[model samples]
Target: MNIFPKAQFLILLSEDLFSHPQETMNKVFQFLELAAYLSEEYLP
Candidate 1:
């Protein structure tokens, strides 16, 4: 699966996300090549 240089496929679990919100989000952000600008205060 070489669509692009950054192309990727990720499978996340509900239990893992609920148990480790920050870690899970970090993985998502890193995969998307995004900056972690939204802090805990910005979340609902």
Candidate 2:
């Protein structure tokens, strides 16, 4: 299975929602953090 590019996906999926600076950055960073943690959990 493949996950593709989450960052790009998130960006495209959230372009309009990210019009505000703080909220957009906050949400993106939060998703990044979660993605990192999930990656770590699946690491070999």
Candidate 3:
């Protein structure tokens, strides 16, 4: 039996997120449909 889902999985590395916080968060927010809640402080 498979433990993890094949189609709805996302792998995010800490180093990448730290290096590109704004860009990474933008993608995450968009994926979660929370872009409308994002504030201007999120951008650099």
Candidate 4:
């Protein structure tokens, strides 16, 4: 959506995992939550 493919973004995350697990996991969940929210068309 931001000129970057989600697939590529995920690959980048995987590459950084060893260096930053806590931060990456937090962000990964955030992204997952956002995806779920968007799919549900959340309004809150």
Q: Indicate which candidate wins on lDDT.
A: 1
Per-residue lDDT over 12-41 for candidate 4, one digit per residue giving the tens place of the 0 to 100 score: 455565576555555676766653222322
TM-score of each: 0.65, 0.37, 0.56, 0.43
Quote model 2's TM-score: 0.37
Off by over 4 Å in 1: 1-7, 41-44
Candidate 2: pairs in clash: none
Report model 3's TM-score to 2 decimal places.
0.56
- The digit string of per-residue lDDT tens for model 1 on 1-44 reads 46655356777897877777788888889888998655573231
Q: Give the clashing pairs for model 4.
A: none
TM-score, candidate 4, is 0.43
Better of 2 and 3 by TM-score: 3
**Tens digit per residue, CA lDDT, model 2, 1-44:** 16775555655245444355455555666866753222212211
Q: For residues 1-44, could you state the per-residue lDDT of candidate 3 as single tens digits?
A: 29876645656787777787777777777767775445556433
- Over 4 Å off, model 3: 1-5, 36-44
How does candidate 3 score on lDDT? Answer: 0.66
What root-mean-square deviation over C-alphas does model 1 reach?
Answer: 3.6
Considering TM-score, which of the candidate structures 2 and 4 is the better prediction for this target? 4
Ranking by lDDT: 1, 3, 4, 2
